[model samples]
Target: MVEGIFHVGEALAAGDVAYLVQAPETLISPFGRDLVAAAEANGTPVYPVSAAVMGAIADKDNPQGLLAVAHTRHVALNSLGPASQPWLVALVAPQDPGNVGSILRAIDAVGASGLLLLDGGVDVYHPAAIRAAMGATFHRPVVAASFAEFAGWARAGGYRVYGTSAHGRADYRAAGYTPPLILLMGSERQGLTAEQTALCDELLRLPMRGRATSLNLAMATGIFLYAIHDALDQQGYFAARAS
Candidate 1:
């Protein structure tokens, strides 16, 4: 289920199979209008409910006057293959739904190939996750796999695995991200195990000067993603804009 005007509109734009849509009669925002138009265009029923009814059905504290129940699409791990300049983010057993969704948003922002969820973690379709993603959940592919399976796939696809660790010798900015790179992040509580760390081609770390030993999982992942994005841009990854 997708809630909020932003998420519901994104779901409609992404061609998700929408079963129903509920919105208050007083929704005047252009976003809400676009959602209704899209739903009508696609033959999806839109029900006009009162604000109280919307509150009862919606999950968010401040409902955005829109909600949609749609099908969630997932990609298989084996189906993913290497590209000429692929960038992927792999999360291992991420505990927080908000973090997972924020990471997905980051992945979309950086134009990464996709996200790989390893082992067990929060469901991507969870309401909190979907809400936190702010519609980025509809923008890219999310695959599920085991650590071993992901490692094997990364090796076979010639992807350089870069794992994050506090004890890593190489600084994150100084590390070279080769083409077809996969940034591996561990869980919030227990970080990547020694065995998992061993699988990485290079382990990178973000320096901490303050009393805080580590950064939030989402913040850390965002930092790495943007750093890698800047590096790739410097290497001419993106095509020059025609002025």
Candidate 2:
């Protein structure tokens, strides 16, 4: 295969070859060179693009030189399971690609199993989301679906679904975030709905220490993910099994 530079949107849309993004060594750089080098050492091709193209991906007020590409990777949700260690974050009707990407990064950091993006949420394949994900997309399972279908599957799979809401009785930190748990985050402007609210096994709320009413979707997700990670560690979920 010949090496050539391409736009993030164009390369990802083509979807037939692996791609990598290379950003410059600047404060505003969208990606780290170490990440690009790592992908290359692992057999993934990496290309550096002109700053103008990088700007398109990063949404800079003015263009700069930075970008990379390779064939995109394919992922299957069931590939990560017995559905035993199932920890999923559900985004229903989220409109911002940046928020989706941030949440995916958080999921990757905490070693979550997968993501179930409900209908009306931002497109996972959107270039902006991909950029925001900062390469975590390569390591996480994120599948898009309608809320109805996902909720039904969650029930059938015996997942203990928890929704975040202001009216929740329990603090988010107090919840048991074990395996087979699904954390649901609603839209940015409005929180969970009556219909969706009814589907949750329980409702949870984050405590406002500084008097802020709520947290950003991404921040809330990060907090909950770390909480889940802490819970898993406490339960010896990270321990090796005996033969």
Each model's lDDT comes to: 0.86, 0.70
Q: Which stretches in model 1 have alpha-carbon errors above 4 Å? A: 240-243
Write candidate 1's Cα lDDT for 1-243 as tens digits. 888778887888888846555555657788788778778877987778888887888787867777888887868887787753388999999989999999999998987878899998999999999988888888888998999999888899999999999999899999998868999999888888998999999999999999999999999999999999898888887653211
Evaluated at residue 214, the lDDT of candidate 2 is: 87
Best candidate (score: TM-score)? 1
Clash number by candidate, in order: 0, 11
- Could you tell me the TM-score of candidate 2? 0.73
Q: What's model 1's lDDT at 78?
A: 79
TM-score, model 1 to reference? 0.93
Residues 1-243, candidate 2: write the lDDT tens digits.
111222333334344436565445332533344444555676766666556555656544554344444444555444444244478899888888889988988887887777778776687766677767766665667777788877777777788888999889888789877567888998888888898899998898888879789888999989988987888888877673221
Residue 201, model 2: Cα distance from true site in angstroms: 0.9
Which pairs clash in the backbone of model 1?
none
